[model samples]
Target: MELKNRHKKCINFDLDTKELLKYFPKGTRKPYALIKEFFEKQGFDHRQYSGYISKEPISDYKLTKIIHQLSIQYIWLKNCIKEFDVSNAPQTLSLKNQIYNSIEKEENKIYNQFIQKLRYYQSKKKILNSSTKIKYEKELLNLYQKLEKNHINLDEKSLKSMREIAKTKSLKR
Candidate 1:
C-alpha cells in the first residue's frame, strides 16, 4: 500500500509546534527556536520533514525508529514541563497541561499503528497458503518482539491469538 493510504488508516495527531508554543509561558526567550531545536534533536527537522514523525509509514523498521524518536521526545518534553515553576503562573500550568495532552496523543497514535499492523498480518494469515503462513507468522512475531523490546505494550489476547494461528499452521505440515 502507498504511504498516504497507510497514514490515512492510522490515528492522526496535530503536532503543530507553533500552536503548541501559544500555550507556553509568556516572555520566554526564543520559543520558536527552542521548539525547533527540540524537534531536531528528536531526529526530525520540522522544516525539512514538513512536520512530526507521526506521518511516517508504519513498516517494521520505520515504525521502530519512529517509536524510539517519539519516546525520546516524550521524555524530554515531560522533563521540560517539570522544570517550569507553574505554581505562581496559571499560564505555565496550562502550558504543562497542553504538553501532557500532546504526549498522550502521540503515544496513543504509536500504539494504534502497532495494533493496526498486527491486525493486518493476522488477517493476511487466513488467506495465505501454509508455506507462506509461516513466513507471515515469523514476520508478525518479529514485529511483536521488537515492539516489546522498546516497551510498547501489545494486547495479550491478540498476541496469544497470533501464536495459536502460527502453531496451528506449523502443525498442519
Candidate 2:
C-alpha cells in the first residue's frame, strides 16, 4: 500500500501516534478506518496538492492536545535558554531560535490554541506566585546581563568564519 494516495481519502494520522500509543493500552489503535470512511463520504482527497496528501482532518481535542505538547516544549526550551550560562551565549540563542521557528511554522490553528491555553493558564495563575516563572525570569535577566558583558560570542565566531572565507577568496584572486 502506498504511504499516501491522491484519490483515496488521505488520513493524516499523528506522525508520532505509534510511539505515543505506547503509553496507552496495549494493542490500542487510533480510529484510522473511521477517519478514512468519514473523509470518503465527504468527497475529500480527490485532488492532490504539491504531489502529497492535500487534506488534513483532525478533531479539536486531539489538535488541542498536540498543541499543548508543543507549547510545553516551547516553554521548556525558553527555560533552558534562561538557565544556560552566558558562556554558552550564541549557541543557546541559535538553539532557541530554531525551536521558535519550528513552533511558528506548525499549523496556525494548533499554535493559536496553544497560545490561548497558555494565556488562560497565566491568567488563572498569578505569575508572581509561580516559582517556576520567577526562576525563569531571574535566570533570563542574568543571562541577558552576562550577554551584554565583553564576551567572545556567537556573532564573533560567525564574523571570524566570514573573514577566513574572504581571506581564502582573496588569496585565490
Candidate 3:
C-alpha cells in the first residue's frame, strides 16, 4: 500500500509488506491493485476477489479471536490515518485534544453518578430501617442463585415484570 503524507512524501509497501516492492511513478496508483498483483506473482490468492471466500461464512471459535484482532488492527489504522494530515498541525492537535477532553468530562460525570448510586445502596443496606430493602435483596439473591444454577425458567413475562419494578424504583428516586 502507498501511504502518502500531505507533503507529497509517499511510502509504498506490499499488501502484507513482506512481498517484493516495485517503485512506480508517484502521480496516480491503485495500492490495492498493486498489492493483489504482487500477491498473484507470489502464488497467493486474493480471497475477497475470488469466489472461494464465502459472503457470510460460518465462523469457528478460533476465527472469532482472529476477527477481533483484525478489528483492533483496523481501528488502529483508522486512528493513524485521522492524525496523518501534515498541514495545520496546531489546529489538528487542538481538535484532537478538545475531543479527548470532552470524552473525559463525560466519563467523569458518569463515574460520579455511578459512585453516588453505589454509596446510596451501601447506606441502605447498612440502615435497614423498613426491612423492605432486605426483602428485596433476599428475593434478588435467591433469583440470582437460581439463575447461576440454571434452575430458574426465565420467561418474558417475569423478565418484563422485573424490569418494570426496576424502572418504578428508579422513577421514585
Top lDDT hit: 1
Each prediction's RMSD to truth: 21.0, 24.9, 18.5
Off by over 4 Å in 3: 1-20, 24-93, 126-173
Off by over 4 Å in 1: 1-113, 165-173
lDDT of candidate 1 over 46-155, digit per residue (tens): 53322333223344445456446655755534433322210111121127788879977866766676577667766786687976767666666666665666577767
Q: Report the CA-based lDDT of candidate 1 relative to the real structure.
A: 0.52
Query: How would you order the candidates by lDDT, starting with the best?
Result: 1, 3, 2
Cα error, residue 119 of model 1, in Å, equals: 1.4
| lDDT scores of the candidates, listed in order | 0.52, 0.38, 0.40
Best-performing candidate as measured by TM-score: 1
> Residue 41 lDDT in model 2?
48
Instruction: Give the higher-TM-score candidate: 2 or 3.
Output: 3
Scored by lDDT, model 3 comes in at 0.40
Model 2: which residue pairs collide? none
